[model samples]
Target: MESPRVEMISNSFVKPKFISKEAKKPVYLSPWDLAMMSTHYIQKGLLYALPKNQDFSITAFLDDLKDSLSATLTHFHPLAARLSTVKQQNPPSFSVFIDPNNSPGARFIHSSVNLTVADILTPTDVPLVVQSFFDHHKAISHEGHELSLLSVQVTELVDGIFIGCSVNHMVADGSSFWHFFNSWSEVFRSNTISRPPVIKRWVPPGSDPIITLPFTREDQFIERPSPSCLRVRNFHFSSDSLVKLKAKANSECNTTKISTLQSLTALVWRCMTRARRLLPDQETSCRMAADNRKRLSPPLPETYFGTSLHSVKATATTGQLLDQSVGWAAWRLHQAVVNHDDKVIREFVNSWLKRPFVYTMSRYFDASCVHIGGSPRFDMYGNKFRLGKGLAVLSGYANKFDGKVTVYPGREGGGSIDLEICMLSKNMEAFESDMEFMSVVNEEDNKLRIF
Candidate 1:
């Protein structure tokens, strides 16, 4: 079966004509902010060889992108027009354009690299190549007021050339990015854009007769990051394991209150703690973000952009989590999730930025990291995205985007959730092993007996 490299773009199957309509609200990012955030989400340029059709021109394709972005710029927040900055020695921070006058939102760059098909598939230096790329990007910390996002490069050995391009996240989310990409592909294939993007900004907290802002004094906090013992890793499970997990999750709660995500997360916690032999004494928690689109009261309009979700945490003393049956832990997770709502998320953001100095206190905060549970969101289009070179965990939790790691599938069936765990290089194997074992425990009904 082929993955959905190119597919129809719309809410349904129908092609859209006329400039797409977007909600008119002032909630979207300023050009500058968009530039910085884009660094975090933009996938490095993908290298693929389409049939050498006569219509394909990398140069023309770029010109079309520039035109698309130029037309869309006026719709973004003015602040989005600014660039991100970083200190000279910091890990690659998200990029910021140095020329403030250069107009907000830069067009993506395209370049090419030369490599043999065999070299890309089995080059002994691939891991080193990947690791070095990540390391170069890590130096992007901001000092004083400097900012920088990574510039991507692709080396196509077969073509014996390279392609370089950059995308800003503020202008688009994963969904929007792919939307833009697919549109670009359509242009390439047909030399005609069947549909131009609909640019809309949905601002929450709609203007009321009485003055009301979405957040109060207690709504936001900025703190320096603290140290953490929490481990993060991603691993893949067999399709059978997921099926078994869902079935077990359903049966565990008697259909009263349980979800597949909740069940698997609780199960993972128990298995990992057991392997470390710390299940008996440690207090561990599982944190996941719930999409607030359908969960919020009055539900925010689909057009409303910006942060729309908050973290939900489930916990158990090491003993309770490890000793209790898996269903019980899942129930705890379900309960915590049930208790969550928009108000709680609001309070969290408000509280985080409460004190004027709180935002500057990132030097003091600790033990507050969130570990997201996986969900179908990772399936970008129902097809699993095969990881290409220079890729990091595409959507792990960060202080960005609802301040939690997101674990949705890149596209539906893009491939099952890559429970791939990322960590400092030294810990990668250990985290991978833990995920592998955890996946098995969730799969076999009798496996728990061994513990």
Candidate 2:
């Protein structure tokens, strides 16, 4: 398929209406944020269809959006700040401190695309289709210049508008990211902000040497090698199929019932491992991000922002993963989830204090790995920016580097799920034809239920 044609109309920065009084003071990055400093920026995009007879003016629409963004930034002022390091200390330390004198505003781009809404909605190559809507480069260099923690691109099409946003991972996780987006949408639609985020940084009590010192290290920023032949394909599973899978998983063991996530993840892991054609004893694993907001003692507020997440991995030999039933893999995943409690969170903090450096999970990004991200709980479909019902499509631009798997609520809503899987182009071809992998998918031709 040919790349979608896009033309940049304008580029500008949107500053806050008025910097908050508290933003004048410098705030340190939390331990969680420090740990995630080396990762790539998080990006999300949404495509909204415009009514056929709707009167549209690009200039007026952009003006309204910029105005609302400025108002929204008053509450989320930190996003307008830049990352700076303290040079007075023995080793320079980095923090997201605002210099009231010169704050780097968020980047906003207005562009025009030749494609229509139907072109995006129709079935096509997942990676190319999604990447065409993204305005900025995938990677961000945080070392040299002032960092704009948040950037937005609004692309206008004949039948729709594509809104793309990029946020530095150090500023927020999935939950926090959505909180900002929802708040912006609320402000744009109703001229009012939602619940303001809790900006207080949470630090464990103790003056231990490790706890006080910064975790930044030059080696921690080493970039991972990008896969040479990566490709993305999307698969959908209906709510009924998930229920059947959960029931089948539960039938394997009487000790505990497996959840839909666990069953689905296990199925994906098995399929990916088989498609890769790894050795029998090759190590294979599935890694998922677990939210630690409620798991912490003195649970973080619902509005608390920043990265309050931890990774959990379920592992087995490729032979075992392939030879075992889906129930067996689900049980393993279920156990991994059970293991991440309050104690585990505390232990993770303590461990980070000791090591104090950012690093990728080597096993989780390996060829045999299947990394799961995003969650069914997020309200992806409800993000209406005063426009009509907007459909959110899973973008593959961010996860195209490795064996990444992103999960989102299906377009039909209800409890159904859509999984966007990324892998080597050759393996994807084999995976698409795998009978076991195809069994659970909701296909257009096969209408009969397998169970």
The CA lDDT of each predicted structure is 0.39, 0.74
lDDT of 1 by residue, 1-451 (tens): 3211211111111111122233222233322222232123344233233224567555554445445433433232221233333223333222222223333233233333233333332321122232221212322112112322222333333432223223333444444444444444444344454444444333334322111222222223222233233344334444456557767766766774676667666666565445544435556776765655566667655433333444477767778876677778778888888888767655554443232122222332122223653355532331111112222233212232211233543211322444433333343344345753555533332222110
Q: For model 1, give the 10-residue run with minimal summed lDDT.
A: 6-15
**Best by the lDDT measure:** 2
What are the models' TM-scores? 0.59, 0.91
Off by over 4 Å in 2: 88-101, 127-129, 141-145, 207-220, 361-364, 445-451
**Per-residue lDDT of model 2, residues 1-451, tens digit only:** 6756778889888888977678676556666777665566777877887655457666788899999999988887777777665543556554333344476588898888777765665553453655655644555425313657787888888778888887877678888888898888888888897699887666676733223445355554545435577877668898999888888888886645689999999989998889889999989989888888887878899788777888799999999999989999999989998888888888878787666666454523566778898888877777777666676554625535557888887767789998878788888888888898798998752222111
**Top TM-score hit:** 2
What RMSD, rounded to one decimal, does every model reach? 10.6, 3.5
